[model samples]
Target: MTLGALMLVEYLRKDMVAHGKIGLTMALYSTWNRGSSYPRDKVIGLLGIIEPRNSFKPEYSWTVEKVYRVAMRAAIAEDGNLNCLGLISEKKQSRNKNLASWVPDFELHSEPFRDYITSLSKVLNKWSIYKAFMIPGGSPDITTDEDDSVLILKGFCLDSVSVVGTQAPGPDFESVGETDPELWRSSTRDALNQWRSLLPPNDIYLTGETQAMAFWRTVLVDLNQGRLASKKGGRPKRLDKSDLQDLLQLETTDGMEGLLSTWESCLRPIYRQLRLIEQFNRRFFRTESGYMGLGPPDIQPGDAICLLLGGSVAYALRKSAHETWTYVGECYVHGIMDGEAAVKAVEDKSDFTEYRLV
Candidate 1:
């Protein structure tokens, strides 16, 4: 391995130690093969062993081995960023509250415990059902409002497309608890087969891997500590089929071709929006809210601009009837928005739409 690759592998090894063997390295690059150009952010992201502030060091001062050593130490330390322990500690100390209890059973916002579980369940269900999608990557981003209410945002879309059909099937389990061992084995295989068949023939899906699990755990710890009511039985709530329906954006198809076309149309806008959001988050680096990266508006707050790629979307897969994250992976085949070349990308992809920040 090159110095950079060695540094990265060591960094990931440290994270695995810190995060209790959970797969937290999806934030690292999986796109390239052995000798391709490295993605710098992913390497830095994996180096969560170092403080984000101290991640990149002066090239002249530190040798490759020294940097790797330092990163590994950071990953295993008490305050390491590689895992949720520190975050859990912070959650325990915080005085904020959870708003999940206020969410209603009939409403998507109601029954906060069930709500979160339901969303998670759908992801699990998708993983079980879809054979073509790769496992989910990175982590889910969870936040809260000023009112102490929680907002759980999980990012999944076209990114999980590659491993579909290629993954060796995992061992199956029957129900969470099964009395008959033989029946359980058979049921497990049946379940796996059912999952493989339910997915669309050629579409992409999410896998909700280890990093996503860690993210969910942290968010749950935060929620439990916050103002939300604890469950009566002290057990994590389970979401059933009906509850699952409320969280997904499954389309009622008029037909297959139309459905595909509509989904394709809706993708560009969502991709643009997510790119802007990621850029804004990186630039500001805030724990909470602020106007996106464009700076405060001269007329109002910050002058906000929306860059529309490929004109207006031909159609949107999930309509904006409610506040929901619309994920469109694989849209940016060439580049992302964080680099120095971002301006060029915008110019090449679409016209930048300047708008008033509301």
Candidate 2:
């Protein structure tokens, strides 16, 4: 076991530097290719990045202990609403066109390393214990024999409720002439309303790209240091951004106006990347009330945004059967998603028992 661990570590060090520090998956791994032996960053990065492929096998050379090592490497990627959860590869491998959602799609390509994700997810599903859940699919529940192998987890999901895609002001706002500011203004307002429809009218919306939160961090990081309050409080003491602050001072209108202003301030950052908008809306967002946040790959009818113990945000999974589930995508749920609701779930003894990834 010790020798195996050493070999795996040495192999991964080369893998880490060779791949520019990008995370590794079991599928991507080849025992024969030990990777570069130099340019070591001494950092394995987050375990979430590696897709646990199955090309590596047990008895021959790979063991369950090796699988645990892979998951341990990913264990560091802990976030409540991680911006990169449920992340899949845009470049699909032509042959790997048929995955039944058994694995968490955290790879850069559709064809996971030899379906290792299936086996890896099973291990993680077991290790997750209380927080285990299946993606929306069919996989018979099976148990891993620890005596035959070591059990470990790569990543887990968080309890979330909704997904909020970008609400970047439309092209009209960008190209609209200043001659009729009201036209541009009205168009922008209409867009804001459409964005609002993605989430609940009454519930709060927690976004992923948070420059606002980062800005507040500068102010309170020193003030509170390690105070849990700073970590748990909601709405960052009245939206500290200067422009939004000034707008609020001028007009304290509630309802849509306040919502619009807040929504507008969030546009530039959320819309920072044109590519991410679709993924966030379709794959990452879900809720019980309807597909709020981002849509099109709309939230399915029975989808529930759940939080796993070590996850960044709530992950949406569809219950295909009484206990069978398949991963939908990452999500940014409002209210309970401010890194507190999941804790409350634990306090309430809401331990999960339905995860069975094949």
| TM-scores, all models, native as reference | 0.20, 0.40
CA RMSD per model (angstroms):
21.6, 13.6
lDDT per residue for candidate 1 within 292-358, as digits (tens), equals 1111101111211222221110101121224432211111111111221334443566333221110
- How many backbone clashes are present in model 1? 20
* Residue 278 of model 1, lDDT score: 12
Give residue 65's error in model 1 in angstroms.
48
lDDT of 2 by residue, 1-358 (tens): 3332343465466556665453333223322122322211111222234543342122323332343333323332321112222332222232123333422223222221211111111121112111222222333223222432221122233433544433323322222222243443465555444443443444332444233332222122111211122232111232335534443222233533543443333234222211111221132233544423332243554565665544434455666654456555544343333445555555677655545422
Instruction: State candidate 2's TM-score.
Output: 0.40
Candidate 1 CA-lDDT value? 0.23
